[model samples]
Target chain A: MKRRDLIKGAGAGLLAAGTGIAAPAIAKGVKQWRMQMTWRANSPLLATGPQLVADYINKASNGRLELKLYAAGDLVSPFQVLDAVADGTLHMGHGYPAYWAGKLAAVQFFAPIPFGFTSQEQNAWFHYGGGQELADEVYGELGVKFLPSGNTSVQAAGWYNKELNSIESFKGLKIRSGGLGAKVLTEIGGVPVQMPLGEVPQGLQSGAIDGADFVGPFNDMAFGLHKVAKHYYWPGWMEPSAVLDCFINKEAWDSLDKDLQEIVKGANAMANQMVLSEFVTKNAQAVKIMKEEHKVDFRLLDPATLGHLGRVSQSVIDDVGQTDDLTRKVYASYRKFIDTVQPYSELSEMAFMNARAQLKS
Target chain B: MKRRDLIKGAGAGLLAAGTGIAAPAIAKGVKQWRMQMTWRANSPLLATGPQLVADYINKASNGRLELKLYAAGDLVSPFQVLDAVADGTLHMGHGYPAYWAGKLAAVQFFAPIPFGFTSQEQNAWFHYGGGQELADEVYGELGVKFLPSGNTSVQAAGWYNKELNSIESFKGLKIRSGGLGAKVLTEIGGVPVQMPLGEVPQGLQSGAIDGADFVGPFNDMAFGLHKVAKHYYWPGWMEPSAVLDCFINKEAWDSLDKDLQEIVKGANAMANQMVLSEFVTKNAQAVKIMKEEHKVDFRLLDPATLGHLGRVSQSVIDDVGQTDDLTRKVYASYRKFIDTVQPYSELSEMAFMNARAQLKS
Candidate 1:
């Protein structure tokens, strides 16, 4: 019954002209609502996961709630999704919390910060470690309901052109990165360019940027970054595990009946699982193909190199985390969670991984 | 909208007498179907996750379908769940695939094997990597529909009484374990004792077993293993990530309308995510408690000993995998998936973990 059909993007998702607003209307006997996502057309992990959420909600509601999806720039730009959803311009919008950092500093803490929580840790924090309560307090101020919808499990460090033997190798290099990772690069005297993922391949080939860390192998390979940059790197210290969130206007969310609300919540959780699985499965396949068929040279940043970056990352995070009162509270939670979970994760999953890796040829 | 409520196991889940048959009866204009689980009443990660699945299905269906849940031995024994579901004695059941290894050796591959796929990788394999198709072929023979419902993310190496410095330390010692882990223990001249997880604490206290590999810190701590054994070890090489599945009778599954079927599938996926997140969070909290409050001595098994265990494990798997044609096919798929996923996982998440661990105080 489960099929991996490519989600139709652009106009195909809606049978009727969408108002692109939060006010739901009763069409015949069904309730109609519009949803938008911060993803371009045919984007694999980003768009597909949200599309599944919309699909699940539409189907599981059994003609009660009909949710139509739109891609990034289909209704508005990716960065404006939060404001659009909050102001009732869109019923619901799916995007990364990091995209709203410029508007609210506290939101950045919810995104994947450098050397921060992994996907598993992030999920645990959101559900168990008082994260949802914190989210309610922070995002609730903007009249938006926040839900962790999807995650990009541990992205690749990125694609590179020149080999890195030292921290000095990063100086003056223009790299397309985002958030705390970008700040760390800036601290190291590298130019951090903020550009969309789709433009990265051309940027690297035409010398617009020396390097880029858009996403993991699956997404990076889709952009044809491997052809432009032979030295592909791993352990994306930039965004270890990015959590994608689904934002809904508080009024629109409150307007839904109890059963419809439950359907929406269940759809978000299902999409979270589906998104990570897709990333893990596709990244594995992509890496094997890039390595064996495309002759991409996969490189690891040495421990010393990573250590220097990690130090810079901590300082950058400290500056951002201390910007305001809400940011401080969120950072405290993140700090305690990481302090509690990291040691245990290292002993259990990380130790198992080291042992398993050695067993392989 | 999402809340974590303790699942009412045993009698509380049903309002009326359950027929425990696949033939759904109409009750107050709602279709009623009964489901049983391998978990006992009030089990944390195990029963709670599956109960949430039932709750989601119930609420999302909006009274169209009412699914009742039961705990282990409430309707039938834990080991009988598969057979009960297959024969339509139970409309649906939830349990690990390894429980039915005696009935069909091929089903064992679907469970967590020694040093096999991690939770993320396992999720990937089940969804992608042609695993579900293989499941349809393998489990379709048993008149049951299989869906991956939950997972225990990478368990601990388990608890031990004696310090493990060498392979000989395990010789002639009784350890409560099961599946391929038990087989590996037997290969190493250790007396493998099979018992329920709830019994591990009493067995260790009574000197019936010297050590036990019941589960990770969360469940094992719940069994009061920390009170029995001081030396808690790292990297459970036995069952890296065990996947718990929801099994539906072919007849019952086919009887559902398309919308109801989607609800069922969506609930399973949500449970899968919740289960792993609970494991990750609880294990982290439990380990911290065991160390600080209980003063449990956390230990690491040296790589040389793990290497030896891995070697025996492969041989044991080879013997079991070669037992029949279907098993061989399943084993081939497992091998291909691990070989493809492991290298990339090692370089990405594992590498980032090591780097992050080094950064912490």
Candidate 2:
């Protein structure tokens, strides 16, 4: 049956809830499902994650549930992962929800708020700390169900043509960035330009932007961003922990038999890990070459700039808190979870770094 | 100041004859080194990969290269990535050599090795894939360094207490899986499984694992395997995508001059992707609902076990020929690189899991 039919069948829940029925209707006789990925054909994580999921489902269902993954440009633009699935144009798709910050501001926080929780803590909040409920409330309104798809650790500050040492250096700097980090940069007097990944290189070269913050080394190098900028900075403050999502059309989601549902959850989890791991490997090597071999200047995004960015981020968060009920609820859950987890993490890494800095050489 | 000094200091390599010139030692005045992680602390990848590197160097350098993680473990694991270090270890550590299996491996492959490349081929073939000649080779071998940290994705066919149907029944056995299509299972016998997040409970309690496989989901699931298993399988043939490493001892790794080394290469290239990605997130979810979820009956082994786990896995390639040579070469590079990466990792995860898995899930 068509993917849309599966979603309609699951919609029985709406009617059941309205009628006060005890159970929702189950979509039966589903043969195959498709998931479109936002990454390119050869992206290690993008390619491998879906491949693993397809393999798992095919084996589990004994060949009944086939998952076909269409890479970016095959089914839709990389940026359209949310809409295609939410509108029931596709069964599922993989991407970072923060990409759709305009549609829902809270979506950005769910993925990565500047100086947000790390991957582990974020997962904790989502799975155990009440973050998922808040996310569902927001996504439910969007007609999609999102599962953590992957993570990209703390990212680099971005490629820069000039060194940045203080908060003043950031003022009026035209930069290519997106998601909530863009909002924070704007607050700090830097101009944030949002552009698709494919368009980044050209943006930097033509002077449409001074620099761009994309994923780390491998991806940046692959796009030849180094040729356009020399000073590469560290710590992607905007996306301290950029999280990706596996968006499934809610209607299509509710139709599967119980066992099938678990498979999807398990598959997404596996995909999340696989993709992240790959990014780390490729990015690390690329960064090494970019610096030592290629002569790229590597530096931190100056502590002053960092501090200012932090303050700006907080203000943006406060603004979001006052804008909508959904944002407020999610913000509260997010803030509570972050506060609880940060202490332990800070003690382990943050505290260690502070003390290490004082060590006598 | 050359990359070779970094490799020698890390003690990860044996310079080719006539290439043993000792470079000048550390000139002095090094600041703290920031290492990006592809793993979260709780995930197996995180447990075994980065933390070990950090702990080792913190003590060895006497606090010279004070390493700090930008994300993962706490900030980003599997998702938060993009290493910008110089050298190996955190400069490089943990990633999947097999991820480039597409560009690296010719066949339509993404998963590690179902009967394809061994850790040896996956690693060895990399040397032949022009990858070895590329910066990756020097980086993979003498320049950086790495090791095989953990292997959780070598998974199990999930837990179930019922008998599976004919191949057609395979069509109906809702399973949770990912990656390579279950073409082999379909070739043999069974259905496919794919579904959403909410229905796993009723599925498993109702006899889902009747044959479902999701890596070692038991670690993360709240339910115990005994609650749903009538059988437990082995050698996760489908996965074959095992993990290995690329790591450098911090002091030895960081000894090179500031400008010439990037820890992001070699060990980190492979480790970042494979090390934590495989087990980081999966472990937690494996046992999320063991007891509350279902009643499992542990099955010893399936009858077709030996049939599927055939001669090929151990010694199918008598010589591996050109293919085998390439595999051997890549594995050899991995072996040499891991020599440097493994020592510290062993003290961390091996010590913990060997004890922990015994205590609980």
Candidate 3:
């Protein structure tokens, strides 16, 4: 048979097989999807990323696929997103993989690790360095298809009421942090507290927490952390480049035709690029406002402290990876890619920034 | 009249008028387009960027809008791409805006400037900092629609036969460079020569050029420059982040439906992100190969030399911007965005990299 005849035969065979699947829904004109995000309505990059994804997909598909977005608590709680999407409570979910670290240890690597890859490097690892396959292997078992939909560049280290003069400063300090960052902080003698971002401002104000590491300047400014914290820190070492994921019900994904699938992928890719760029611009503007207008003191962590933290971070990552065999496999792949990308980054980005500093001075 | 009746009336009036327009093309199922690229067939990021854009559009449109890509010299010629696309000789073209410096001096700022915005900063500026509006104003007059399709992250400075130990080394030295970089070289007393990338290896081998700056390690390795040049330099200060452009014929663009237009835009955005990520991976691997297998000597341009070059680069940019009103407008906007983004980068990306270095040691 010719190729066209073979496709026709296969199509007829599949249809005649009486698989009561997505065919009926697809034929009903516009397919509406409900997507739940693990972010507040006005969350900066997190909320905007999913919103852009929906806009892009809707515009590109010409109403063929209409996705309605729901902020956190609209349908289900934030932490319940994975289970909700997996069980088909929602067609999709927008969240960070690290949020599900309690259930799957390897998920943290897929989100962001302490002292992990930067935004550019992480995207590279995801698309080209076998990351997507490894991610599929992990998320596949959960019955959800994973797509990295956005990035919040390198986050700010945190907002601090007191200066971090040395590694000893971390001892007995209460820090509002989550995911692997919390683990690294705990290893370094700091008390790590998990609280919703909404509570961070009050937590710092009430002296419940000495510091907090949120998304970045843009989101931190939104939370009014700079108003309470006098000193803002540099380089969010815990979550270097935080990635936001779009988790689709595996059944929903499998049901889509090739064209709809491609549209969804393209939309997610656009969102991934757009959100990072938006963060770069908005974060810069927010920093200027915080520093010049709000008088927030920008401070860098001392070299010795950073060095100590880095060492502790590595140990934390190793421990987390050893929890299961799959985590170990994913962690090994992540490490190898990071090692491979480091030298080039040193020669190019690192060297350029150093040279730029000299020029500015 | 009712809304539906008004639309029906307008449709009837237009049909009665019988204007010879896009009706016939809409009746045709698939719209095939030809796109030309200003890169060799085997070029890494440059060629791949445009090819991916074509692939994305084809797949997303379900072959309704098929784009066929032509490499450099395959059609008219590399330099004639802009003109060809504008005159409708080709439906689309991929190139750098700096290539059109002779026609529009302001165009170089849109592409890459010596010591200008980095990859992340540039994308932010283009999307958020009034760059797209300014770009539209410039390109609209030329009857083409411009879209930023790809980026080559920070490039390696160059490969040299001898060491660049001080500022004096640039004086009277023959360097193969182009665009703003060549102008900066001229200001710093170097005799900048414009040569094709293919001829760089032979030029260096024959002692015709002392050093050459190419795209990063990946493309540089493909050109076999490491075989002839022993010393590899860090931080391509000249073209910090070179962006690739996709130029579509205005007439061709206007003929498409809104959905198709969005698909094109999303495809270009996807290409932009994917290409940069691809470069990060490939360049890292290439650096490793050059260092281990080829034994290329890695060197940093001394602080004093870099500082002096930075000064001259500023002067070149300032002079270039003063050429016309549009150039000045773009230059002002570019400068403002750069200033806004620099502080955040210093606190985030720069600080993280520096802290990372301390830890590795």
Candidate 4:
């Protein structure tokens, strides 16, 4: 093979193995950039979002822009993706905005919060209700450009070894969880342990953690959590839905021509919706599989428990949203949007779901 | 200005007036196609979806593909879009599948059915649950290619003259509705009336039609339905959600290069999600506006009424699905998808929405 052909072939092979080594050929004005996702290695479901954007950008641009994709820790630590993209070491990074909440409290609203926006509502806010602009304002300070890139629509609450029949069922219980949800758990006298998601199944099996929240049925089943836990709970109060963050280094983004820029923008929007469709489809299948095959006992958190959790969550969100100026502004917008949309949502989406349920029951 | 520039300028002016005249310049491999939408003129919400796709395609292609778009009655009658696109008189067309169900019964499932798939569920089915393949198979017979282009999300049951408190309230009621929903309405002892959307307000004011079921609050308020009707009802059981159709003439599509083809696919996908976001945000705003300014009374159909409607809807959909072999196959796929997703949707979407309403109340 010719030297150039061999180099291109090796680059493609290494890229497939998640290696960041892309001595990428840049001939004939074809641009190349490295992109990495926060999703763990070889996760087909979560990685689908980033891959769709990368593939679309490449195909739609007719090979003008090539994005070399990597999974978490393949190029940099998942926790370091923000800083890497901000510093221009990485051209583009994909993850949830909630990961950066420590740097900007407003990020939580963009990602997930207890009983926060569902997939459709959160997406409406971003694309139509001024959310993308607010997000741009917040992320601009960090030298990053933001796009809503992916979604894990409405998760299951978690899996528990025991049925959570009442509010008191949470007291003295241990679960593997993190972020804002951990604080809410603490408030109810539940112990939130810090454990790797990879360790969750073993933790539950060994009685180290009595419960765990990964994603919905799709990812949970992938981790074999249902095999160890008896009760799968509902309403995913801690994370009703999550939108993945696509961050590009500001300097790198500014260098792209208008054609490539629009391709990236349009491709990311397509990815945003595609990811939700994937999750909803896969999660449903997992729920059915776990129910019929594994005999997993599914349960719902009772009204009293949900009500208590709701009150505590509101207080928590309010307290956190008051931390800084951006958070304050973002929270105001977020709060106003919810207040504006909730009544209609209650009548439309919620009412329809309830009616469907009533008919089925 | 040059002669070419003058022609281009005149074309732009005429196109802005919704004229189909594009005597479009196709110099330098720049492809130009006339596209028409079924949305009414000056209706911002519905038009936004098609406009987004056109703009994205033009910009992303960098003027290679100039999609000059027209509204209903501009280039052809709304009823003629499918025939236009199929026989190659019109290069492209955009509208709801329900509009063409008279030609092919399976089209209704892709558009709307009483107690049918909500926006998210419908999208998931199309993109992930084999609905799109079935759609392509059905539409391919008509010598056209199809894409899921837009969504209305979950609509309000629509405007009413009075509160519908029970199943009996629908008896003897006169409502302006169409398609499978109208069939279910007739089954429930309601008289379904035929009327143009432009005349609905006057008709409602004169009690010619007691109520009208239009596209949710966004389009409903645009037609001033809230002014003539005192009560708004919801769960939108008759038309839970509606997805718009983007169809291309088969020969025109086959002639496109791969890059332009991918752009079309990605742009349509983006359009599908954008319409939903636009509708959701605008519908919420309209609900707020009518509630405060017009004092519109919002009501919901009770459980028993919804149940009766649900049963009738099933029978209606079943009968239609049995009309042909393709529809029966399509219906089987849709039914299987609904069964796979509904249980999980109940737990996550419904339970979360219920918990949210409980908190707010």
B1-361, model 3: which lDDT tens digit per residue?
Answer: 3844654464355346543223334436788777889887657778878988899899999888888777776665799988878876668899988888788877878867877888988888888888888887788777789898988899888988988998788788899988888888887788988898889999999999999987888888888998999898888898778888898989889988888998999889888888888899999999898888988889989888899888888888999889999889999999999989987888888889888877777
Per-residue lDDT tens digits for candidate 1, residues A300-343, read: 89888899999999999989989999999999999999888998
Where is the poorest 10-residue window by lDDT in model 1 chain A? A1-10
Best model number under DockQ: 4
Each candidate: what lDDT?
0.83, 0.52, 0.84, 0.84
lDDT score for residue B312 of model 1: 89
Task: After superposing candidate 4 on the true structure, give the runs of residues whose Cα lies further than 4 Å from its correct spot.
Answer: A1-25, B1-25
Clash number for model 2? 117
Can you write out model 4's per-residue Cα lDDT over B3-82, one digit (the tens) per residue?
Answer: 44654564456446643323346687888887788886557778887788888888889889998787777656788988
Root-mean-square deviation of every model: 4.7, 25.5, 9.6, 4.4
Provide all candidates' interface root-mean-square deviations: 1.1, 19.9, 0.9, 0.9
- Report the C-alpha lDDT of model 2 over A252-285, residue by residue, as the tens digit: 7887655466556656655555555555545555
Among all windows of 10 consecutive residues in model 3 chain B, the one with the lowest summed lDDT is B18-27
Cα TM-score of candidate 4: 0.93
* Deviating ranges (above 4 Å) for candidate 2: A1-30, A349-361, B1-361
Error of 3 at A165 (Å): 0.8
The two-chain DockQ for each candidate, comma-separated, is: 0.68, 0.02, 0.62, 0.78
